[model samples]
Target: MSISPEKVFEVAALGLGGNIGDPPAAMAEALRQLDRRDDCRVAAVSKLYSTPPWGKTDQADFFNCCALVETSLEPEALLDVCLSIERGMKRVRLERWGPRTIDIDVLTYGTREQKTEKLEVPHPRMTERGFVMKPLADIAPDLPVKGRKVRDWLEEADIGGIKVAGDQDWWRAR
Candidate 1:
């Protein structure tokens, strides 16, 4: 069966992370797949960084980054795409903050406020994750979060070392 295209919302932000396998490579592949989706288009990508794992630090440090996508898919549908990418990368949900091949979370879906058993808009903990905020600021510094700019949030946020993974096409198709 084929899927029908819907009117895409102008902008969306997705947070990507992983600590297993080649994290940078997995992140890049996720972006490539996302960009290939008919209902979504990757508009921008933030610099990659390595950070101490949140929730649990016993595992390997996480490679993290964020991407801006233009899409017509609703929040849940968008999330499905992310989950598919994670599964394709062999993500194992053994424990919270446990090592995985890939992890993708929707940070924001346009400016809409939504809450359901399955998903939440403006990600419940976006402000708390340095991995999410740092890259978010890199790409959309002036973006408003809860009526305040992302830069302001970053300044007040308890964020630590975040190194930019150089090389723009590091994950591009050959």
Candidate 2:
């Protein structure tokens, strides 16, 4: 079987979440910004989900989702893009796992495993965070990021109080 060059694109999964400001709108803007990039294409998005704050409990509940994209950019470069989007949204870091305007994490890239000062693929604690796993399972259930499929991990994750929200996509309400 001859592989067509047209079929080549690295799949990157990004986990988006926020508790401050208009999160859905922020996330939508991030998605649009990502799709607008030349190095990437937003291929799939999970339905938005509501989940209680993970490490920081006093903040408002977070709106979360996962974006699946096909990109030519390498892992760290993709991470730079995600951070740029977060900074554009005015993310503040007053504390570790603190509440923020937005958080865009590079969950994984094409089964890669890496750790560096700038980024970590497979997102270190992703499998332990139900807020990350649930929506991820929604869009790419069969993705083998680690040894297990996203859906399989979701079955074991307890990210807590995660519920689907309606009427939103890459173009969410303003």
Candidate 3:
């Protein structure tokens, strides 16, 4: 079967979450910004979830979700786009696992395995974070990560305080 060039975009998954400000709104805006990019398109977005803060338990709960994007940009460039959007949304990095206005992580990129100072595909810590795994499973249950499907990792993740906050179209709201 001849593959069409138009069907060659790489599919990437992004994990988005935030605990400060209007997190849901910030996340929605971030998704809109990505979809506005000429080289990227938001393919699918999972339901919004309210999850307990990990690592730093001093902060408020976080709103989290995952999105599948079809893009022509390379993995690094896509990560750059995500970072740019976070900056645009005023994300402040005070400390590792600290609260922020918005945070976006490139979870996977077209089945690639990459490690760099600035980015990592199939995010190294994804399997251990229920906040990321649960939402990711909603959109791409069978997606492979570290030789395991997202659903599989989710089965082993600690999802104690996670609860659905909105439907699949949650990102459509302001």
Candidate 4:
């Protein structure tokens, strides 16, 4: 038996975060840019979440969300698109985990595991972030992470002050 090319699957999991000017608007613009790609389709999006800065907590809190997309592009190509969107949004990567006008990360790209100098699939640290897990679980409740259910991981995850920001649809329909 052999697997068919048509059956070869590809899906995209994107994590969006921003803390600089009009974070919500920046996210909406990112979604619109993703929607413009012919090889990808925005399938579902998680609710917006507000969480304290993870690493350098000396900055503004971040507005975060996750999006599940269906894309035929390989992980690296998809990553390129994400970076392009960031640049177009005037994103300034001044510091590690620092406040930004917009930030987009490829959290997962199908089940394919990949590592390159510039990108990593199934984002190495995604499972450890509550902001990522919370929204991911909401949209993909049964999603498996390191062999555990997303919901389960969320339960024990230290999400302290993370809160649902506003109407979920408000961001998606943008």
Candidate 5:
């Protein structure tokens, strides 16, 4: 769907990562693509982070980060955009928490709360993952997730091996 100039924008948070191939390059391209869209604009991006794998834990560490986007699309539509970005970057769902070229997750959409068969907003597991929270804190430390600030959650999240891999302008590189 195309957005007109008069469309109202909503601020949304996104979690992005990957463990295979040139994940950082793929992620930067994803952001560039999103920023080029008429319906969306990347407002803020967090620093890149090298973090231990979560969930499956057996694969290689992931390069992770978060982005704040101002978009005119609704929750489901935003999710569709994210999925399209992933697919375009050769993302494949071979296994749960397995390796991939790129992964983009919609963490929040304004103050909206949604749970549908295809997507969920304020991502159901955002608070439980340090990979998501740590980078998220860099861009939106005071942003609330489930009534608690992201920084507050960061304090409790297990960020053991997570480390900054790049500065906030990391996404600007080709």
Candidate 6:
């Protein structure tokens, strides 16, 4: 369904990562594509960071960042947008938590919680991933996820190898 450009939508957050094939460029392209959509708006983006691989630690470290978005699309539709962006970036699903051209995980959609086979809101692993929280704090430090603030979670998470890759606004720096 085509969304009218004039429509408004609930605020949402997304986690983006890409460690292969010009990862930063991949993320920038994805951001540009999302903003080009009439259904979504790229509200805010965090600076870029390089974090030690999460889950599967056998490959390249991921370039991680988070985005604050405004969207007229619902959770499932928004997820479709993310997956479309990944596919556009030449992402192939060969392994879970494996290296990819791009990875976009739906972190939260208006405080909703879901456990469907298609998607999950407040991304099941958001709180546990410092790569997600650190950049998230850059945009919305006080932003709450499942009743807990990003800053608070960051303080509690073991963010050992997450490094600051750049100080510029990665989402709009293209």
RMSD of 3: 3.1
Off by over 4 Å in 4: 1-9
Cα lDDT of model 6 by residue, 1-174, tens digit? 997666759889989998887888889889889999898999988889999998899999989998888999999999999998898778999999999999998899877888899998888888998899899999888887888899999998878999988764765676
lDDT of each: 0.84, 0.87, 0.94, 0.85, 0.94, 0.88
**Candidate 4: worst-modelled 10 consecutive residues by lDDT:** 3-12
Q: Write the per-residue lDDT of candidate 1 for residues 14-56, one digit (tens) a residue.
A: 9988888888988998999988888889998887888888889
| Model 5, position 65: C-alpha lDDT score | 94
With a 3 Å backbone cut-off (N, CA, C), the pairs that clash in candidate 1 are 8-72
Cα misplacement distance, residue 117 of candidate 1 (Å) = 0.4
Clash tally, candidates in order: 1, 0, 0, 0, 0, 0
Candidate 3, residues 1-174, lDDT tens digits: the string is 997776358999999999988999999999999999889999999999999999999989999999999999999999999999999888888899999999999999989999999888889999999999999999999999999898999999999999999999988966
Q: Report the C-alpha lDDT of model 5 over 18-95, residue by residue, as the tens digit.
A: 999999999999999999999999999999999999999899999999999999999899989999999888898999
Listed in order, each prediction's TM-score against the native is 0.91, 0.91, 0.95, 0.91, 0.96, 0.93
| Superposed model 3: Cα runs more than 4 Å off | 1-7
Leading candidate by TM-score: 5
Name the better of 2 and 6 by TM-score.
6
Which of the two candidates, 1 or 5, achieves a greater lDDT against the reference? 5
- The local lDDT score (0 to 100) that residue 56 gets in candidate 1 is 90
